[model samples]
Target: MKTGNQDSSAVKAPDAARAAGTDYERIFHPRRVAVAGVSPGGGVGFGTRYLTSLQAIGFEGEILPVNPKGGEIAGLSIFKNVEDIPGELDLIVIAVAAEAVLPILEAGRKKGAAGAVIITSGFRELGTSEGIGREDEVRRIAASGIRVIGPNCFGIYCPKSGLTFFPNPDLSRESGPVAFLSQSGGLASDFMMTGMWMGLRFSKVVSFGNGADLREAELLRYLADDPETGVIAMYVEGVRDGSEFLDALKAAAAKKPVVILKGGLSSAGGRAVVSHTASLGGSRVIWESVLRQAGAVQVRDLQEMAQACLAFSLLPERVYRGLSFTGGGGALGIAACDAAETFGLEVPPLGTDARGRVEALLPKSGASGVNPVDVANPYAPPALLEKIFRAVAGDSRIDLQILIVLTHHFKGLAQDQGKTIEEVFPYRELADRMKAVAVETDKPVVFVLPNAKRGFPDMDVVEIHAKVREAFLERGLPVFDEIGDAMRAIGHVNRCYGKGETS
Candidate 1:
């Protein structure tokens, strides 16, 4: 019953995605866009969110809102159909109903639409014959030249182009080196926003649910070729073609680091994935093997993916070996050593010369001159701390240094010792000294403030902690709440870069 054109398109859809002249830029960087099914009253729903988001993100284009019973929204006149709109339409956002989508695509094609983002749901994921038929119709429509993003997705979010899917993303407009692709719309939004808070900016973000037309493999290829994107972060529940996906992943990883968080590895999660996106969840063993063979970093959760991406974005390619830390008690030093060893990082002791240099700066009463060189107190004089840190960095055995400053809890400890907070926690001076050591040393330097607090009744502690962390972050130093997270990120990066060297 299929037409010849539809049959051919179905066969070549994947190839067409990677063909010349057609790429992500045409889809994500559209000049003018039209939104179908936008209500004039500005009530809640998909249509309103897309319209408002475009405006909020400062999308510089002609926004044509289409509605059968429309008059105007936000002082702009709404057209009744795509054909009624004047001039050429680059992109169309179909947000009507499932039954109404085919006709809209038909109109858009007639108007020479470059691409379409189908935001309407109730298709194959509904698990009904009727829904499957509707999805078939969608595929047929997409096969006839126009590219489609999703039938149930948030669509594109390109900061440089001022295009967004949601209002108030709490992210800066400045683009960075990371590009993210997620099958789940909610998860994409959550990860993108959370990554921003952790100082991870993005080059582009796509929430392509179902991926009926533009699937994961195609997206990976496009990102691999993307100049703006230096790193790729992906959250995938399943893939349509395992062989093709692995090929694309390997190709992409060859260009830049690819970090993935694969969901639906378990039986229960696999069933959930089917209902969520109508995907075929692969086995965990096969997935792990493919990831290892493809040279991509596999993470257990979105948080881990974010952490790994940060390391790739910020740190250069280098092998991290010896680990050193300052501050905290002797137990803290032991714990740091354990974490470092667990991640395959070395915790070599300071050399005799370095030990003597540190011993001269620290009080003989409380402090360990060995590795994870704890000064027993974070409030030690900045000059003395600088001497110890420089000596450790100057040592040939050390590759990365961690300065652990107990932020919130240190003020109370200082008060108990009959010393003012300023005398104990000289944040400015400590930051200056850390920055000095970073400049002088050839190794990586990071800060660890475990007791960071926010929005608590203890506003004073929160403010002080924020200030200290900000200082470290401003100096281009990564600050982690736990030593485990810092060590894990470093270990993953070390291994990733290590592979690159051998490859």
Candidate 2:
């Protein structure tokens, strides 16, 4: 599997001809791309799958497939060698064997390609002298001219350019303000899938496996300055340079919200990190200190990270110090207040005028007009909820509002009326009303739709919950499954934008 350009002298040395600056525009939105190591017989190789993924995502770029066998794949003629491709190449997707990667990358550099995503494995992660040597060669070639994303990893997924990761053909093409970077390809893929329903869209998602050339620090700096990226999220097993990473983290966090989920902090996890990415998992205490000093929001898991990203993406860039909670039960109201206090937030009592107005709107019995105004009825109508939300928003001390809607209880109404949950529950009207209240009151309103019944017998309730969640999300209202998650997400926002009070 040799290329036509075997002359090593064709490209300049790494130190002498390093690229002045990375052409991120061309690297991200490439108009012409080449996929190496694609077999014509259509085995499930990385190269072939990537090509199909790009095609499936409606990539409007010229795809040039290369194979030494000189066959065809996806109706494109296979170039026997990289040198035979016409004109300059914008990007190259390399998935050949480890021994063949260096020459292919070198050939791509000679072709004036802007960047390459190396999907082939067996590099430094193998912990072999030969494997390390191969990765070194890849880094050296990358330094000459072309930028590299990975040597043993999944590639980039830019929704704007329709460039997708391997085995992810159904990912959303709608570009968004969120950008994610990860060392583990599987985590990156999983996060992308999770973001689809979680209402977290993305500008760019890169899974730079092995990180031989371009790693976390460089990408962090780039995303900090990227206009398309508003909220940056990262999943790090380890980083190449600790000092550089800290500096980048500080700078990026200063510019925008940077939510990081540090993996391999435990003793057992650290050992796995070495075998997974061939990087060192730093000390937990030091990492925590670094994250705090750098002003980055640190999350414990992917779910928390996703929730933080959702909050940062949707909420205003200010400290939400005070909250107004409205729910169906006093227990939920008390729980909300407790969670709020735990997160350095205040659920203050309403003022005299506001309290009276809110109380007048509630039921005559078993209802309270205090901070967490309990309606004492699960079947509260959307019009009534809207009025209550507006009344609470009128409080001067309240910075934000949370309305807990128990949509599952509507199943009983559906059963009485001989209707489906979807027909009986006015979720669409409720979403529209809540959005209108938020707009009219000039305060963000978060919705908490909790379902206590999720068993197999309650599939209808699950479907209705999903539909209601989507409806709220569509209206730009962040919905959480539980009140605690909502408060925690808000706490993250306050910590990022607030002074020492919320921290």
Candidate 3:
């Protein structure tokens, strides 16, 4: 795979980025990373897991440790201050206690550091006198033309160079098109972990923590031009410049989809809205109008937003409007229909002609015969599964079909091995046959596997399922984690790109 361009040739920063494009370049794409108050714990808190994650991926950038503890972390020397580092530092990570950040910032500035990522949490969030003092010190230094990432935040990442501190205990760094920016470090970490299942690699991910200097809007604009980024997935705790944000969104949307998981949106995205953009459109009216006007997709949470973007960036060429489902749950079927409807789909009732094919496929007792062809009863078989789907061969309503696999024998699979034929995932041949039906019929098909709690198989088996979806997607079919995601994708495709088979 072609990695994104690492354009180090300094360009002029937008008037928005403090009129210094060089600053955004140095801040966003760092060559050297420094950790203050580094930990050795294997836990997410701070430890060897972090260093291990970096080294495991073979980060190319330089890493320096600034800890008063004076102990070696990950077998590397831990210096007490940022100035103590050997060469010119591109980024400084402040993980010490909040009160200890100011001195570090001063030291970094004096040393001519390009940027500092403040990972300490107490300040600003706790709203104490000390927190206020910490905030004041950070602002004072940032004012001197040195960029600061957070005073109450976790960290940031440039995966292309292996400078991620957003915490990935497992999963490799070279994963997909996503360039994520968030206010919560935990989400950034977990989103990457979960996203890995679907090949959702990231170009770079940033935890703007408290947004002391490099605010969300500024970061979004920087990513808009970053060649490594294809889709901009943002978790907005707050947007500082509303007009600037709208301008940035409009500009970026022209090239890629801007999927927003706008936090604090209940108060119409309360803290995230008020703190970030200072521009309020009265929650209901303003945001809705803007979203439509901008043609940006707005998702509910971080997972939804990330997954949606992953699908968007990786999708082949077109979005199919056809939908066919073969699952065991009535609620999922109903929910799929309802959600897809909102996305501008025509979920017509399963036709009588199609019902005949389903009946012939698995006997009268085996199929739902209607829209979400519930094909997996205890008596499901390879022949029965294909026959039921053959019913929708003529339905012209939607372009994609969904199969919901209901294998609740997951716990049993744990006792088995990765290659256990009796395990639910070992049914890849059957799944392949289903995929083949879509291929032969020249239709788009997606599958949904329910009963995840039943623990049917190992992650490799799960990977098998993901691979099936990926294949279906690669062949112009849209697959989703939930039937709803598939349905949502279908609707989005029809509206923006037109009704056609999309891989």
- Top candidate when judged by lDDT against the true structure: 2
Candidate 2 per-residue lDDT over residues 181-263, each given as its tens digit: 99899999999888778888899999999999888888888899999999999998887656667877888999999999999
Instruction: Give the TM-score of each candidate.
Output: 0.87, 0.92, 0.72
lDDT per residue as tens, model 1, 1-503: 23323444355465645444454565788787899989887776677778877876778878899999879886679998889998877889988978999899879877778788888888888989998898887778777777788888888788888778654444567788899998888899889877876768788898888787777887898899999999999998988866668878999998898999998886332444535334543467668878979989899997788888877887777888788887757888888889988888888999999888888877878788888787877556778877888888878889888888777776687679997555567788788878878877867678877875555666767767777877776676777778888889888887777884652
Return the clash pairs for model 2, or none: none
- Rank ordering of all candidates by lDDT, starting from the highest: 2, 1, 3
Native-structure RMSD, model 3: 8.2
Model 1, position 499, has a per-residue lDDT of 87
Q: What value does the lDDT take at residue 206 in candidate 3?
A: 84
lDDT (Cα, 0-100) at 247 in candidate 1: 76
The TM-score, computed over Cα atoms with residue i paired to residue i, of candidate 1 is 0.87
- Top-TM-score candidate index: 2
**Better model by lDDT: candidate 1 vs candidate 2:** 2
The lowest-lDDT stretch of 10 consecutive residues in candidate 2 is 8-17
List candidate 3 segments past 4 Å from native: 1-20, 23-29, 39-53, 56-58, 68-71, 110-112, 126-130, 197-199, 266-281, 326-339, 347-398, 409-426, 430-444, 452-481, 492-503
* Residue pairs with backbone overlap in model 1: none
